[model samples]
Target: MAFPPQVRGNKVDPDLLAQLVPGTSSRADVIALIGSPTAKATFDDNTWLYIGEVTRPVIAATNTVLDQQVVVLTFDGSGVLRTVERKNQDDSVPVAVVSRATPAPGNDASFLQQLIGNVGKFSPTQTDTSRSRQGGATNPGNF
Candidate 1:
């Protein structure tokens, strides 16, 4: 039996994911449950995000993004499943991170003060270069 293109396309096994619901699944189990994630966020490894994008361009110049889904699952401090959210088709909003530079609100330790504090804490008399030398014959005269 021939199925429609949408039906024939890749799909998530509703039954398998359904079976594992409310249970703490390990890394391997999560992989089995849902294939490799599309993107791994920065500064946060405990969270896994899986995304799928479908785009279809028709016979004309007009193109269409058929569907896109982003499933985000968060693991807690102990690496246990904390929450799972399925953001399926057309459920996402594009946002851009703004990079702006603004001065501190009040007068605090300036950049140079912070640098001086760190340097002052160091022993100026300590010969650090003396520790750099390593290689030498234990008893060169023995040869």
Candidate 2:
């Protein structure tokens, strides 16, 4: 069975963005034209970003990114739009994932060690007080 890809964030329209004249459009005007951005620069508020991603579920039970876009708008100190940068999936760098299992202390237990791990660990002669307190294992004649 196939599952539909999930789309997140707003998609940028180049035509509309092209109409915005740099040095003329203010932060408020940009917001009015394109709505709120997905994120702003961490260190500065002058940079705004419109990010979109399409993710599909893989057999490994994790979502894989199919496509992504990031439209970045930079404004000057006066809040006038200065530069607009658009990046697509090809611009992104692939990061290698480490799937190696973490090594645990004394994890190499033998089959026999596992099989007899609980051997003689409990007292066989000890009566199960819980069963006796709960009417014992002997079933009542009828429900």
Candidate 3:
């Protein structure tokens, strides 16, 4: 059985967001209202980001992007909220994905090569059993 793709991150609430006033809401206020951010800006220390995405995979098909959302919160040096920006899937830019497969670091063997690879690797031999039996001594009791 196939399972559905999962959704991650907190769901944004418009009513709660409306209460977050810029220049008045502090970092503690945002954390209390919206919870922890999904990510922070790499280049800036004042940006908080929230991301949500839903993916669904179909039979004989690549994983499809059902939904995507991004919420960006900018803050001033004083830890006060400065701006709130929201983006959706429609705002995304399509990128070309290369599907080239990497070759492994080993000899590539064909079916016939693999089948005949161990042809001379092993040899069957029979052990002699006609020898005299020994009773825990160098000389055997019966020869």
Candidate 4:
């Protein structure tokens, strides 16, 4: 049997997210009320956060719904919830990604040069174990 990654066909519940409030609900309350978040940050032990996202394309082959969520909680010096920031997928400006590869400064050889280099690296003498009677060394060279 073969199994590949597949996406689910349902959207997340925004109604549940709309009910979240700071300073009133704790971590345990959040879990009991809402589900676990995708990711979280540990700025301190007193606070927590949750996030969600979705991505879609036009082409069926490229069409995809990518969901991402982040949770962040910050605490004070006395171990109290200072702040909680939950980042989710929202309508925002797109960021560009640039990639460039620089060739390493070195000698690039041709096919003949590569073949000659490999041939030159070949050992002049090699040992054959099949001809050894007492399990010692045996000469493989014909000459």
Candidate 5:
């Protein structure tokens, strides 16, 4: 069976984008035309970003990116649009992920140890006394 690609983030329309004029459009005008941005610049408040992507499900529930669009808008000190930049999938840079796992402080058990670890930990005859003290019925028939 085929599944539709998942669309994420806001994709700007070219017609509406054309209406945004540098030095003329304010932050409010941009918001009215294309809605709010997906995110603002981490360090600079004047820069806003509208990012979008389409991903398809691949093997083992992993997703592969099919398309990506990023629109970067910069505003001047007066809040007037200074520049508008658009980027596509081709402009993206591939990032390599590290496969090394971080070592956690714990005992690493084997497959057999993990499978039978709790074998004798629970006793079938053991009943929680706390439940009986709290006006709750203890099911002696249940193990």
Candidate 6:
């Protein structure tokens, strides 16, 4: 069975993007032209990003990226568009993942130890009959 390519993120239209003039377009004009951006820069609010990707399912819970697009827009402090940048899959860099696991503060116990760990820790609950209201009557309904 073949799976279709899944489209994700904000896909910007080329014709609409062309309508945006860096020095002339305002923040509201960009939003009106291409909707809102998918994300904004973490440290800079003036920078906005529109990201899109097409991916196909390869294995269980894994996807193979077929195409990617990113449009970066920057606005001046006065809210006028200052610069527009476009990037594709070729511009992306692969990041390496660390496999080292952090050790916890507790000691690791064996399966047998876990099963028998609480064997004798609990005791049967005892009741005090001397404080009973009806002189240690076994059943309150009997009276």
How many clashes does each candidate structure show, in the order listed? 0, 0, 0, 2, 0, 0
Tens digits of lDDT, candidate 3, 44-77: 9799988888888777876677888898999999
Best by TM-score: 6
Estimate, for each residue in 20-104, the C-alpha lDDT of model 6 and write its tens digit.
9989999999999999999999999999999999999987889998989999999989999999999999999999999999999
CA displacement after TM-score superposition, residue 111 of candidate 1 (Å)? 46
Q: What's the true lDDT of residue 23 in model 6? A: 96
lDDT per residue (tens digit) for residues 1-143 in model 5: 76789999998999999999998999999999999999999999999999999999988898899899999999999999999999999998999999999999989999899889978888755557666555566845544
Overall lDDT per candidate, in order of appearance: 0.63, 0.86, 0.83, 0.53, 0.92, 0.90
> What ordering of candidates by TM-score runs from best to worst?
6, 5, 3, 2, 1, 4
Error of 3 at 134 (Å): 42
Among all windows of 10 consecutive residues in model 3, the one with the lowest summed lDDT is 125-134
For candidate 1, report its TM-score: 0.49
TM-score of 3: 0.62
Clashing pairs in model 5, backbone N/Cα/C closer than 3 A = none
Ranking by lDDT: 5, 6, 2, 3, 1, 4
TM-score of each: 0.49, 0.62, 0.62, 0.48, 0.71, 0.80
Clashing pairs in 4: 49-71, 51-69
Candidate 2, residue 12: Cα displacement in angstroms equals: 1.6
Clash pairs, model 1 backbone: none
Candidate 2 lDDT for residue 74: 96
Candidate 6: what lDDT?
0.90
Model 5 global lDDT (CA atoms, 0 to 1): 0.92
Better of 4 and 6 by TM-score: 6
